[model samples]
Target: MKSSAATDNSSHHVKCDKNNINDDGNNSFIELPPNSRPLEHQIAGHFYDQSKTKYGLLQHSNGDVLKPLLNPPRGPCEEQFYIDVFCQTSKSKYNSEDLINLRKFLPHYLGTYKCQKMSYIILENIIQPFKHPCITDIKIGRITYDKEANEEKIHRMSKNSVVAEIGFQLSGWKIYRSKYYEYHDKRCVRSLNKTDILHGIAYFYGAPIHLRLDVIELVINKLNELQDYMKQQHTFVLISSSLMVVYEGDDNDQELNKSTFVDVRLIDFAHVFPQTNSNQSDENFLFGLANYIDYMKQLLDKNYVYVPIDKFEHDNKTDTKIYSCYKQLLT
Candidate 1:
């Protein structure tokens, strides 16, 4: 095994004083009389091994009972086994932002027995993606490294570190590489996919009916906020995949009794891009905005109230009701 220059050889050795003897030839260790020192100071002296200067219980503290180390400690063999296993498994796996995110679920998936009984297994199996989503449902397979002989070909267009191979029940299996612009930072290498979106949608759909309007508005508000942020940053925001939006919470202040605003978040940016003159034109923006306005109008017609804003807020109950009515007409 490779060793670091700072490794200490004496760390493994145990030290004890043998000269303090009793009548039976055992160590004649005696606790300090109560008045000799403060109770805490005496307890600290009894617990701490003064000869080694290590913090540990003394043999005489519990009437000659050898108290174990207060802090649970792992044996050297177990520690080495964990390090070796972690290194080997990490090397074999592909690296990606999504995969890193998914890796957080590994501990719970592996279970306590595997984690405690075997140190090597805890590092090895937990680091690798499970065969089924039921076992490892984090979409890690979408960013796995290819072990095939032709891996070089795949690496040329898509760096092995940022891409993952994912299997879909409907499409059989496919490998999608992260667009170069998406993972410019090394820390952004993880396999986030459409499954994450579907999960969010399902969650909102199952939310209580009382919260549906708040949820929908929250989703719309988030997109608007992202648009505003992008405008400020002088970057165009594009939602390439349909699953970019998620409803998180209501936007109301507790102290004030006014209607709360909705909260939304964008995730899995593997496919988002800034609009350019060649790809996005003024006409395109107007067309897209018109379609979006129409969609929002439909929602309003259906009694789905939206946060009222200056210039954007509709007046006249007839016009407001038409917004929801238009939504049903399109359907």
Candidate 2:
């Protein structure tokens, strides 16, 4: 189990246990659980093609034969970079009795990704799913580290000095990767794009209409719960990009109900503040809130709220009720 003292000061800690790791020596991998639908690998061969001249084909996960074109050599001319994919993991088994008690107290930390592509790939590939009009064919290359350079980068990041630079990295990655998919299914809602607001409004107004209201409510409730949890720890929540709250419908009956379990996800923390930074002040909180408001306004101005639906009749009033509830909360 990897633990961090810094997380103790945060409102909540995310712990990733041994179960999360499929470790073989220094190479650690986490295999996402099999969903009812196939878990697609969006990057696949695309990663191999980037900077083909450098970072020669190291090795594939499957010992399959590598074609010459697939083999790229790593060289100085190649734009090498690193990314940290941080997540909380547990040290004990899933059913271990210790987890029952320790789970409540575990803290979450940022996952690091060491990758070669520009930082924007992080947003397009990782953050886009949570937003509207989901993107695809985005590949994140391998992770590596330049000890001296990373040390400097980390020092700057901790002081909130490199925020603008980080933002630039995110934006650049987004534009470069946008070529793969110009547009996605309107219903998917990729991120906080204009289409997302429209979809959110449609989901709210079209209610009494069957949709995933519970999932949205679950997410809101979880955020509230996380907020309270963080308060107890004397930490504040920061909105880096957008958060995702998910609920899985019953496959057996194909019905969505409160009984369905909920999963809340916080995405794109490029702007999140670490509790380790003692320099943060109340002003930071206000700034974060202002940013959040700006985002919320974008959603509302795009008709994210369902104004027409309140006029209709429906059995499940929960959608409108919850939307109204969050409207006030967000404002």
Best by lDDT: 2
For model 2, the local distance difference test gives: 0.28
- What is the per-residue lDDT of model 2 for residues 162-247, given as tens digits with 9 covering 90 to 100? 23211111111110111232112211222224323333333432222344444445444555554444333322223323333333
lDDT string, candidate 1, 1-331, tens digits: 1122112222221223432222233323333321122111011112332423223322222122122222223223223222222232343222223233322212211101111111111111221121111010111122222233256655663453222222111111111112110001111112224333222222222222233444445445644553343333322222211122222122232553223222222211222223454333223223333333234334535554333212112356754543321111111
lDDT of 2 at 283: 38
Q: Estimate each model's TM-score.
A: 0.23, 0.32
Q: Which 10 consecutive residues of model 1 have the lowest summed lDDT?
A: 180-189
Tell me how many clashing residue pairs each candidate has: 20, 45
Q: How many backbone clashes can be found in candidate 1? A: 20
